[model samples]
Target chain A: MRLLYFAWVREKTGISSEEIDLPAHIETVGDLLRWQKTRGEEFAAAFEKDRVIRAAIDQTHARHDAAIAGAREIAFFPPVTGG
Target chain B: MIRIQEGDFDLSAEIEALKDSRTDIGAIVTFTGTVRDRGSDKVIESMTLEHYPGMTEKELARIEQEAHARWPLQASLIIHRVGKLLPGDNIVLVATASAHRHAAFEAAAFLMDYLKTDAPFWKFEEGPDGAGWVDARETDGAAKARWSAKSSSKEEPAST
Candidate 1:
């Protein structure tokens, strides 16, 4: 699956997007966030405030509990400040 | 209509296009958002608006559809600019046309309130001291919440 980072989340992660294979244990957006924290120091810092980081599954806004199975893309970012 | 581009848009032209020689429309309401020179603590030199391309358009269309579903609007337009922008530059424009003033005015406000909190765009401010991402305002979420009970559909508010 492909993962995208935006705004401050992108800055902290130091990369905009990446392709990664999800571990069998990771089934939800929350699970993916937890596993990402263990990847490296940057990922840990980027996802430290996991609750504030919003997630989108297949370009649709998603809650943390949303399933990620069969999802081609997922994105994480800070709360939008657009108008 | 929904347009997400890096170029600036003309307000008059947009309004004219929305009017589109439609004699039935009697009222048009417009709202434009511009970049501010000052942040809460410092003077901002510029702002960079970033967005998710495909998702931004899709989300705007969805918001527009909701506005149409709730009001008797003849036409509507949304234009948002991205990339680097200096203070005083226009960021977004929304226009709604209807046969009456009430529907046009309300729909324009509704679109803006929803866009502020739900759109997939972020602003990064640059100042003499440094730069940082603008924090999402609590008041924006409050503004969006005001419409929940009145909406025809009972969907949960998007997480900001």
Candidate 2:
């Protein structure tokens, strides 16, 4: 699966997007977010303010409680501020 | 049409292209968002708009489709520019055309309201005092909320 980060989340994570073998235990975005917290210092900092962060599964806005099964891409970012 | 691009656009040309000899379209409403030199009360040097490529297109298409579904529109266009840009550059353009003034105006407003809170684009402002990403405003979410009330009452058969 490919995980993408944008805006401040991208700046903090130090990378835009990456493909990884998602852990089976991470069935939902909430679970994936919880596991990402343990990745390292950068991941820790990026996930530090987790609640304000939003996610999109396969390009659609998804709730943290949404399942991530068979998802090709998951993008995490702050709430959108475009016009 | 939905376009997410890195290049600046010509509004007149876009208006002309969207017209496409459609005699049925009596009204056209467009909203162009630009990078003002000031944000958060600070003078901005530059601004960067970041977005997901495929996802951005998908979202814009969804928004455009929603507008068309809600209103009987002849045409609609969304042109959003991504990547680094200087102050005063055009950031996004949304144009909608319809047979009636009310539909054109309301549909454009609806598109803009959704774009503010739902679109994946994020804004980062760089200025003399330092730089920071623009935070989403509660007011924007509030603006988007009204559409739901509208759909439940008037524009009923909604699909995202």
Candidate 3:
């Protein structure tokens, strides 16, 4: 899967896009997020407050439990307030 | 519907284009948003707009279609400029034409409201001190919320 970060997420994650091999068990947005929290201190800090964070699967906004199968892009960012 | 490049537009030309052939169209409502000189009390010299290329077009097209479905609109146009913009430069434009003044006015306002909240563009303001991203505004959310109830009762159009 291709993981993309933006705004404050990009600031903390320190990189914009990365290729990740997800475990077969990570099937939902929440599960993917939980796994991201274990990557490093930066990843942990970014996902610490998930309330303000938003995830989009393949550019479409996704709920926490949205499926991730056959997904090409998973983007994480702060709630968009941009015009 | 027409969305243009980041070039200055003549208001009369845009309005005329919508009114050309439709004799039934009785009203034309337009809104033009400009980059301000200041934001959050900071003096802004310039503002730059960045947008998600494919998604930005898709979102704006959806907003236009929604306005048309809700009102008896004859025609509408939305032109939002991207790239670097300065104070006094036009940021966005919304124009709606309808058989009645009310529909034209309502649809034009609706388009602007949706654009503010749903558009994919990001604004970065540069001032004497530095540059920073523009914050999400609460006023925009209120504007979009007004139309939500009506949309819920009526079938919402599929977004592009």
Candidate 4:
């Protein structure tokens, strides 16, 4: 699976994207956020306020509760500020 | 038409293309968002727009499709610039054409409303004070929420 971070999340996390094996227990986006905190300090800081982060599964907007089963791509970013 | 590019665009040329040989279009509405120099208390030096590559195009196309499904649109165009930009530079453009003024105006506004929230672009502002990511404004949410209310009310009449 591939994970993408954008904007402030990218800056905070210090990477734009990465490919990793889907963890067996991480079935939902919320669970992924929780697990991400154990990765490193940057990941913890990037997801510190998990609720404020928006997510998309395979490029479609999704809620944190949304399942990530069989997904190839997941993206996390701050709420958009574009006009 | 949907374009996500780093280069500047010609507005007059764009309008001319949209209006070419389309007699069915009786009205056209267009909007452009520009980078402003004003910050809270300091003058803004520059603004940078960041967006997802494949996802950005998909979302913009989806917004355009939604507008067409709801309105009698002859055509529509969305052009959003990415990368670094200075004050007074065009940030985004939305143009809609329909046989009636009502559809044209409403669709144009609808496009912008959706783009504000739905699009993945993020703005980072640099100024004399400091540089920071622009907040995900609540007012932008309020602006987009109005349409949801309208849609729900529209559905109520049929559900009753």
- The best candidate by lDDT is 1
Pitting candidate 2 against candidate 3, the one with the higher TM-score is 2
Segments of candidate 3 deviating more than 4 angstroms = A6-19, A37-49, A81-83, B2-4, B150-160
Clash pairs detected, candidate 2? none
Identify the candidate with maximal TM-score: 1
Model 3 chain B scores worst on lDDT over the 10 consecutive residues at: B151-160
Ranking by TM-score: 1, 4, 2, 3
Superposed on the true interface residues, model 1 gives a C-alpha RMSD in angstroms of 3.1
Residue lDDT tens for model 1, B1-160: 9999899999999998899888999999999999999988899999999999888998899899999999999999999999999999999999999999999999999999988877899999999999999998878878888887354322224344
Q: Give per-residue CA lDDT, model 2, range A17-40, as digits (tens).
A: 998998778998889888889999
- DockQ comparison, 3 vs 4, better candidate: 4
Error of 1 at B55 (Å): 0.7
The interface root-mean-square deviation of each model, in the order shown, is: 3.1, 7.0, 7.2, 8.3
Per-model TM-score on C-alpha atoms = 0.95, 0.93, 0.81, 0.94
Candidate 1 stretches with Cα past 4 Å from truth are B149-160
Candidate 3, residue B106: how far the Cα is off, in Å: 0.9
Give each candidate's fraction of reference contacts reproduced: 0.63, 0.68, 0.19, 0.63
Q: Could you tell me the lDDT of residue B29 within candidate 4?
A: 95
Q: How well does candidate 2 score on lDDT at residue B152?
A: 33
Tell me which of candidates 3 and 4 scores higher on lDDT: 4
TM-scores of chain A across the candidates, in order, are 0.98, 0.98, 0.95, 0.97
